[model samples]
Target: MRARSTVLAACAAAVALLPAGCGGGEKADDAGASASPGAASAAPGPIPAIKPADVKPLVGRWVGTAKDYFQFTADGSGVWVRGGQRLWSGTAIPEGGGKYRFSWQGGDLKTASYWGVSLTEKNTKLLFAGTNQTYTKAVAHKGKGKG
Candidate 1:
């Protein structure tokens, strides 16, 4: 029962994190990125397919303003961190149309959620359709363990 409650709470947090696009987009600044112009519009269509190579630019540790982050790996696997603690293991599945689904596993969320990406002057920006929050690629990281 405790596990279920935790999962439910986590699921609620995910929903809260993404209230706009429900997931994520890409940028075209000659940098590694993924997102569509209408990706966060009122209505969405089929997401574009992504290649492993294309996602390479997005692979790395992304830090959020409040210390939340995403550590994406080249093998399509990733870890989502919040408040310095590991939240869940995630899979970055590329859905067609410049959209990447950030699905959670081995934790609270089991459903697949998508997100888009955009390149910045210094780092990369990761955005989900629902929430306005963005995860920027970190310049320096101390590794994950619960800060």
Candidate 2:
């Protein structure tokens, strides 16, 4: 249980620093917005089905904050990095129909934790089902045209 708590703490810290990343300066929506105090809010619309092509485009670094991010490689591997250190890595498998299953091996677990994941906002953001966290893709820059 201690291991789970540590992992949860890492995720919490990542969310707590979201206002300062590649997210375009917009405030993050409340993680638990459904429970926010106000007139009852409508449920969010259904997420679009993930496509097989969507898997390839996920091969890059996605950031929630300067110190927290997820990186995926074309070799079907993904890593979660925090505080400039790699925290864990796992296999990313396509379950077809644009859905992906991530089986990560880390911490105290003898088995892997599998989670459904998908891309949103035109593939600019990564969203994991059953969770409110979102990570924005890091934009790549090219060198200035040679003189």
Candidate 1 vs. true structure, TM-score: 0.48
Residue pairs with colliding backbones in model 2 are 50-98, 51-98
**Cα deviation of 86, candidate 1, in Å:** 2.2
Score every model by TM-score: 0.48, 0.52
Model 2 lDDT per residue over 53-139, tens place: 556878888886435677877755677677866544554566555445554221111222224357777777887542345778888
lDDT of 1 by residue, 65-93 (tens): 55467787776567666765554454566
Query: What lDDT does model 2 reach?
Result: 0.52
Q: Which of the numbered candidates is closest to the native, going by highest lDDT?
A: 2
lDDT over C-alpha atoms for residue 75 of model 1: 64
